[model samples]
Target: MFKPSAEQIIKVMQGKGYSVYDTPAVDWNLNIVGIRANDPEPGTFNDTLAVFQRLQGAWNICYYQITTDPSLHYLTHPVNSSGTAILKEGQYKGAYQLDIHNRGLDSGHLALCQRLKPVTVYRDSNRDNKLNLLEGKTQTGMFNINIHRTCEDYIQRQRFSAGCQVFAEQRQFAEFIRACQASEKAFGNKFTYTLLHERDFQ
Candidate 1:
């Protein structure tokens, strides 16, 4: 058991904006670590694990409680069963959110320092085994994905008779039209595709 000195505590309080209320003299957990005051600012912080690299004789501290009761056989571990709260680095209390992927080669998916509220998805509808876009639940449900995509190999046999695949932007545009069901009313399959709508903005 390490005892915190009064001078060290006062120095920490004065140097950091944190007040005595925020820094109650509490026993720190072994996992919590400290950093040196001279170290550069950290670039990446893990949200899943609430650990900080601080300088000083810095120590590990857990949010969970370790009782002083000698009768207990083990340290009282905090049960975060709900797993609802995601402790992000930098911020003391909030989960980190991010965009799924990048649209280009140069710029990667960057995380905004902003925090977002956690959302829950559930399939509650009258339809049976059909996707309803209006249901509000995204395609995030574990069981909601198409099972055919998971098969190791397709049962049907096929032959490659076609030539090299070309970059057909027109065909790609037509595919998008069928996907959106916007051109189902039109009655022309052989006709060449054309730009349907053009926006003024670049």
Candidate 2:
């Protein structure tokens, strides 16, 4: 498997020229992309790239833990008996909300919803009990594609996610929230999030 360093991920995000989350008094666009490595572990990836860019060419890159089960099959359906889509890989775009009411918790994290073409992984019980992945034309539109923090202090703790991109490190996720909040204050209340597979880069 090809493991990407922080610098490599930034290079890829920078090359894409997507909007960035920067400071105030400047044209800042919040672009957060989660790049999944080719790790075969379930509900976790060996490397995750979280990069935020500023319109003035400034950027911040943070390393976070994503599910190792980086497969479409496990993304929409429950992997094993976890009942979570620990790893969902694809390119997705939707409205980013800075303050959201999720699970009766209101935090600094963000939610990506509203006209979202998100991915879905569900088990086709009638088809011999097999897991299936659907998106785009075959998708029926999914909600709650949130980018939030997790309870895991380390990467190996088996953090749980229901197909959402979770950050195992609380500190890192806090910093991310701060950046997005700053961007929101300067810009509008909506942002853009994109999740790309390792193959999609380069």
lDDT of each: 0.20, 0.51
- The global Cα lDDT (0 to 1) of model 1 is 0.20
In model 1, the Cα lDDT at residue 179 comes to 25
Candidate 1 clashing pairs?
29-61, 32-59, 32-60, 32-61, 34-54, 35-54, 35-55, 36-55
1-202 per-residue lDDT for model 1 (tens digits) = 2223333433443454432222224221111211211211111111111122122344332221111111011111212222111111111112222221223633222221123332222222322222122434332211211000101121121110010001112343233323223212332121111100001001
Position 133, candidate 2: lDDT: 39
TM-score of each prediction: 0.16, 0.62
The sequence of per-residue lDDT tens digits that candidate 2 reaches over residues 1-202 is 3445545655665666643344634744555666656434544545564654544554544455554232334334444453333334444444556655255654433543333344543322222222233332132245454676656432343334545566666676677777777767777666666565687555
